[model samples]
Target: MWEMAPPKGSRLFQTLGRRPVLRAGYAVVIGVLVLSVVEAYRIQVSLSGQHEEIYRRYVDEEEHINTLRRNLWQAGNFVRDFFIRSTPEQAQTLRSQLQTLQAEDADVLQHLAQMSPPSPVPPGVVKSLREFWAVLDPVPITMLHASNEEQYDFIQREIVPRRGELYAAMLDLSDADKQRLRDYDRQFAESNGRAAERLLAMLGLGVLLSLVVAAFSLRHAETLEQQADRHYAEVEEAKRELQQLSGRLLEIEEEGRRRLSRELHDEIGQTLALLQIQISNALAALQGQPSGPREQLERARSLAERTVQTIRNISVLLRPALLDDLGLVPALQFQLEDFQRRSGIACEFVEESVADYLPDPVKTCIYRVVQEALHNCEKHSGSSNVRVTVRQRPGSLEAEVADNGCGFQLNAKGMPDQSRGLGLLGIRERVALAGGSLEIDSSPGRGTRIALRLPLEAQPQPAPRVAAEVPA
Candidate 1:
């Protein structure tokens, strides 16, 4: 006997059940597709509601502004009509219109107050409107009872000026609202555009993933690995280019500092030095003369000396020639001495037996880092005691600048802060370019310590100096 055949639906289910992986995959794909459709509908509805609400608010605000304009226009007209009318009936009619205008003005103010919460209307505009209304509300009746000369003076002094002010305020409010509405349009469009892009990307990724799983999972995985490797290589290449660009920028900056320092030292420093010497010579010539001339000479000499000292300090800050002429240690010592003298903040510099021949870049970086750190300490850290230490190891150099002053939170994310400034960031970049790492330790009311560790192997050899030929 032949067995009864199963139903067509049951047979299909049995076939699907035979391949559990395929059944699961189909279910997942269907579920994702349904979810995508539902999400799209929901997003569209949401965007539509937001768009309508924005437009509705925009329309309401625009109407309120138009009403304000109309109110000012009618007010001016009713004021003139009350003055122009001769008969009692005409005056009474104009008076009624003025009263109606005043009522509408109150309504407009109420509307403005309500609109202000949702619109961009400024409170100043509302205040100006109220002020104008206070001047305008009694003008019609007052003009009706006034003589011709009195009405003319009132129009010139109050009505004309106040009306102009109200018009100006309304114009400003209208323009501001229009700008805000345009911005809203742009923001909404951009938001929806981003959402659409993300949705499309997800749908496309899902479809591709489904197709890949159905066909070749292993091949897809291999392809993904290849793509990831390619991306990583591209990223690494970009990073290298960025690093090279940063290094070049740093080199150009140092060269600029060197040029500026030379100019300040050679030009301005010489000028002030010459002035001091001249003042001294003049004083010698005027010695044993009148007391007045001698006192004037002394003041001139004192000013010249102060000017010379200022020029010297500026030259050092711009770029210290000692770093290039002598070494890093001398430059740092000079800086600490200057800082101590100027700020009255005690400073100490400690050093180990550093190698005599250090790369110019390394020397510059080290000097600049210490200088900026000290500057920060002087400006921000109200600490009385600051210490700078440098040590040379077998293969590396380490330096730390510590302050006993008030410290700040060490921000790792590098958010911009004007109070903290870019000194720390600049130091960090300089150290990184030198194949070094920088560490900052600080807390409020405690102290700050900045440690720099640079690799010795990365330091390039200094270029050989050529002796100038002596004249025969």
Candidate 2:
């Protein structure tokens, strides 16, 4: 059956949604947006500065042009008055004034050219300036040589009319320049305003987006923290349950062992003892009988001894009494000796330092690890020589069990036998629990060496009080 997918707004939708490559996207987007806004703002500032400079230049140019126009008008009036009544000296002075006005006009034109030129001046202004310069160029010489009336008539008729046309053209050009500048100023102002508004809007959006992202991140963090707390609680509960189960299992196993031990010691042990005593009585009774009967009695006595030894072996197999009575070293020694005697294997046991510093569990774990390694050697490798070394250093205790055996392949799935592999796994776990480490090295046709290192620091527990004896 075809199943419908969850809707986009559903919680399941988000959980099943494609993972966002959001952070990188956000960084790229924000960076580009910020750069663009900054660039726009920078351009706006630069253009605004340019606008102000252009406006200032235009103002200065217009003022100079106006001053030139006024000077030219005064020169024309001075020539008119001098020609009408004054001497040739006054007329020559007026001509000098006209020369000064022309020079001033040239200076103003040069200043305007250096500044930002407005759109091209009208054709009429150019024509007027050319014609006015043509008329005035000969006027200086004419004023110097001609009669005052002739000079006055020349200035009033030709120079005055042409100067008026030049002045009007100059004013028109200045107004056109001012109009063009005003248009540029308005365009620049509008562009700057629009850019600033956009930059501000983008900044506001960026801040809002940042706030949203932060809030979402904070909420996610809180959710994660709550999840962590819940997981911790669950783990603690599981641990408590595991501890209870382990304790219960250990108690049951110990109880069963005690019952079995008691049954062996009380019932089977007594029966064996009674059988030995009966065999002795039979041997004694047969002492005066035939030699054949005496030999039978001997056979019976041997059988009883064998049976007793077998029972003892069974009891030892169930639990080693030496482990409880004499502690770890003695128990280990007994086991090694028994292994050598039974297997006829060459074995060496070396102890570097004898320190009663290890806890029982650690000792047991190490002993078992050695036992498993030796068993593997005997069963699988048929190794003849085994060496067990124990050393107690300042900070740690170390043990190694090595055998000159044909080692088997060690794969990731672990040792060949699953149950047997547990021995190594258990050894590792036990060492780790004791804050230690274990290493195993082996290869086919080489040998197997199991090394274990355990911290010397004992598990923290209340110290036992020593008994003080009274003077007797």
Candidate 3:
């Protein structure tokens, strides 16, 4: 079966499309340059042919005109000799030359009829040739009849003057033809010059286009290199951030261990020791005087209850049960109350609930951030009042903490001085881990405010609420 071939134009286009852009551009430019060269050469050849033809024609006409002038001059000389000599022998010789002159004149006329005149032959010159022939027609006939004196007078007076006039006309025509030939030569020179100029322009344009293409390619490569460098720099920065995060986490862990050890050793261990002494005293009292042991027993029981409460408070600080059970609102309220009692800083909570259900991670993140913010304000701000607000927007939650306290300048890293601590850094990292953002605003002698936003989409919704507010 004969399959239909694809169209030639489509096939050519497809072949060009598959080539590299630079290669294709070069091909197109080279093709155009080649075409320009060929056209210039063709035009030059054509112009040269035309100029040569004009020059050849002018040469032929000039030569023929010179021959005609020579014949006319020779015929005038022969007649002059015949008229002046007045001898039979001289007369016979003159007659023979005259006959030869007649034959030459006939040949000149025949040549003129056969050949085209040169360009720029003046109309006056053509009329002069006709008059010269008319004047010559009577010359030999008059010579045969006239005596020597009469013939001499006629040759000198009429034939010589007529020949002079004809010669002058032919010379003028020849000069005109020469000038016209020079014009054609000049025109050919100008055309050649123009062709050279056009060829140079085409080559220059092609080179300029190539430079432009090369410049664009170089610029594009530079841009790609810059992008690659930027990407590598970003990767290095991320690695540095991970390292810093790891170090900070280790520091936080160590601090927690020290705090727990102190709590266990000083508070829990002392309370247990004191309870053991109280129990021992109550047992002794019961053994010795049962009647008076009730008061001692009651005091020991109260001390034991206080120790239990202390442990509970520490556990709540670690991870509040209210956060898991009652949700973010109640947990925040409980934390604020505790913060007020411990720091002597009056604290308030405000909520704008956009959605009722809050994810556990989001709730925990917010609660921890708030706790840290309050702690920082208590420790660094020296403030007596603190306000915390949590607002719910579509798909996200925003929390802001502001304190009426003496604020200090933060370092370039946005961390307070080492004497103050790394509490803000901890909060920032925590917020980041929760896929949120944190902003701190503080100035010297002014109050500090920290705002954070956490995305709620990652949280699993368990309930919903419109709004909630807590008073200081």
Best by lDDT: 1
Residue 16's lDDT within candidate 1 is: 65
On residues 52-88, what C-alpha lDDT tens digit does candidate 2 reach at each position? 8878877776787777678667766766666565566
lDDT of 1 by residue, 1-472 (tens): 9999976644754666535645566677777777778878877998899899888877887787788788888877777777777456766776677677768767866776666365555677677767767776656455566888887788889878877877887788778878878998898999799879878876886797689456544543565799999999999999989989999998998899899889988998898889889988998898779989889989998998888888777778888889888887778888888888889988877777666578787888888899899888988899998888887776788899999988887666642254665888888889999998888888888988989988776444344333221111
Report residue 458 deviation for candidate 1 (angstroms).
Answer: 9.5
TM-score of each: 0.49, 0.56, 0.46
Give me the overall lDDT of model 1: 0.78
Model 2 residue runs over 4 Å out of place are: 1-160, 229-262, 279-308, 352-363, 380-382, 390-398, 406-420, 432-446, 453-472
Instruction: Write model 3 residue lDDT over 107-224, tens digit each, in one string.
Output: 6556655665524445576566566656655554545667767776776777878888878877886787788788878887888888788878888887887775676457547767
lDDT of each: 0.78, 0.69, 0.74
Candidate 3, which segments miss by more than 4 Å at Cα? Answer: 1-198, 201-205, 208-317, 352-358, 382-384, 391-396, 406-429, 437-446, 457-472
Superposed on all Cα atoms, the candidates' RMSDs to the truth, in angstroms, are 37.9, 10.3, 13.0
Query: Which pairs of residues have clashing backbones in candidate 1?
Result: 383-405
> Stretches of candidate 1 above 4 Å error?
1-212, 216-232, 287-299, 411-421, 458-472
Colliding residue pairs in candidate 2: none
